[model samples]
Target: MTAAAVVLAALGAWTDYPELVTLGLAAAATLLLAAAWLVASPKLTVVREVRPRRVFEGGSAQGTLTVTNVGKRDSPPLLVTETVGGHRTTVTVPALTAGHSCTVSYPLPVARRGRYVIPPVELGHSDPLRLLHRDRAAGGELVVHVYPRVHILASITSGGPQDAEGQTTSSAPLGGVAFHSLREYEPGDDWRHIHWGATARTGTVMTRHVVVPDEPRQLVVLDTGSAPYPSPQFFEEAVRVAASFCVAAERSGLPLQLRTTGGAQRESSGAALEFLCTAESSGADRGLAALADLLRDVVSGTQGVALTVVTGRVDTEAAQLLMSLRPRLLSVSLAQLVSPDNTLPARPRGVLTVAARGSEQFASNWNRLVLR
Candidate 1:
């Protein structure tokens, strides 16, 4: 307002217009008064509430905001903003009454996964004359959790582990370790031996049905530590691999578990794969650090039905871990599965590794190794 007054006085002197000087003086006085009132206005307090703290990406969150003016007089209009997954938006609010409150509600759309911090809500109070606006900082923060992206895969095999579920198809008639059921013999059935007693009682032909043994339960250890050249595309590829494995395993009647060196373990029903999309992003580990940490964690836990460690590279520590587990478990290494020259160290018997160019090729790659 003072600056405005000075400008008006200078213009009045240059133009030598008495009417212009009077108008400028009146405008300056009004601006000065508004500034004084704005300064003397009471401070406002704001609160933000987000429903369902943990939400999946592509989900909607209904958020409510409450504003209360602690001052003795009515406050200016307010604007509330909400940020989600790095996206920002502003909302206009009605004038709040002194010592009274008003509520505003909006929807927050989550487009990506990961833990995100919702920045503080801002309160903007502009004077009636609209010369300037004052902003006040509000307290309180919100933490949102987003899960991983899920895709459909026809076959799910733990790339590194033995079959956890005992599953067999009708085509593979060879004897299996897991016993299913026995029935009267049928023509063309395995002639090893027939159930003579049951055949005699029924006076008809039947056959034996054996429950297929499921492949070993596979534990996919993801190396999420920082990479030399960080790329979200790499992370996306890793997620696709994990999703493909989970879907394939679930379809094959196998139980699967997920663990990460960069984050917590995610093990639940097949449906839990949805949350994996939001794994945390870490830029702390470099070179072989991620592989070392993954190996250490594996030694600490013996639950891996089959260990399939998914990483960007095959390091010495990882090779050693596989060597150590070779005698006890069927360990598979999935590193840059799509790249040429992708190879697994030759040491442990029954250990197979394959390069997976993409989701469509995972099954073919596994089929090549499985036949071995």
Candidate 2:
């Protein structure tokens, strides 16, 4: 445009045509106006929020951007570029009158498991003609942690308790087959015993935490070494499998020990799901080197705690390690995620092994094979 304008002006001067000169001067004035329009930056205060920062996989999260016009003049419309990890989305914020505020909301993707950081929005301004543009940083980083989807695989049965699948307690156990005190609903508590009568009377959901004799604490170990998995997908399935066990423990309202072959261990901690959100497959068989020490610690200190190992494949050495740890616990179970064509090594005689192709298969296989 500048070149064209200069040429028009030069040609008009040489040809002595007044019309060409007027057109060039008009074009230059328009360009200058566009620049001047953006020179007065919009004075705004921006606040960004990620509602329900922690969500399950396959679920979605929402982000809201609030912009307030703090200047004496009206604020121009803005273009906000929101970033979620490597993905980016741009949204338009409507103009706001002085001392007023407007909010722009957008969806954030949580389709996969892991931690994602949503940084501050980049506030953008442009002239109505869209010629001149500028952007300034507006807010701070908001973190969204995506957790594994816990399948409602196990049905809540009216049948006798029998220590309910995952983990348990002291001489006082977990169940409603026997009556106990009632309390309000907590996230990890089982939905089976929702004291309907009390819930109706009080208008609040409640559950009965019945106590029984001789409850067992459980240890769930995830084999995170890379060698066991033929592909990355199998490792992810294994993670979901491990998470299922932890969630079961939570539902049972008992103590659970969660550990990984990479030396990451959580003792009956409620953050097992959070820990697995960022769990990854590391290099070499050497990554499984810490499994023995981690298990040995649990074996020496605790008693009557059942053990379950979730893995991708059971190799000779891995099977041997599990076999050696079997004698110290009351029961040992193995959950393996393997490809359709892969052949698994022979599991120890007393240890139970359930093989599956994915998280769905793992859940189905566990119900059919172990529950029976």
Best by lDDT: 2
* CA lDDT of each prediction against the hidden true structure: 0.62, 0.78
Candidate 1 lDDT, 121-222, residue by residue in tens: 767777887887776667677887655444444343444434424445553334554455666666777765566666777887555665435455667766
List TM-score per model, in order.
Answer: 0.57, 0.77
Give me the runs in candidate 1 sitting further than 4 Å from their true place.
Answer: 1-4, 13-18, 42-45, 69-75, 84-86, 96-100, 151-219, 225-231, 240-305, 312-324, 330-372
Model 1 lDDT at residue 133: 79
Error of 2 at 44 (Å): 1.7
Cα lDDT, model 2, residue 177: 55
Clashing pairs in 2: 173-212
Q: How many angstroms is residue 90 displaced in model 2 relative to the true structure, after the best TM-score fit?
A: 1.8
Q: After TM-score superposition, what is the CA distance of residue 309 in candidate 1 from its true location, in Å?
A: 1.6
Model 2 compared with the native: what TM-score?
0.77
Tell me the lDDT of model 1 at 315.
54
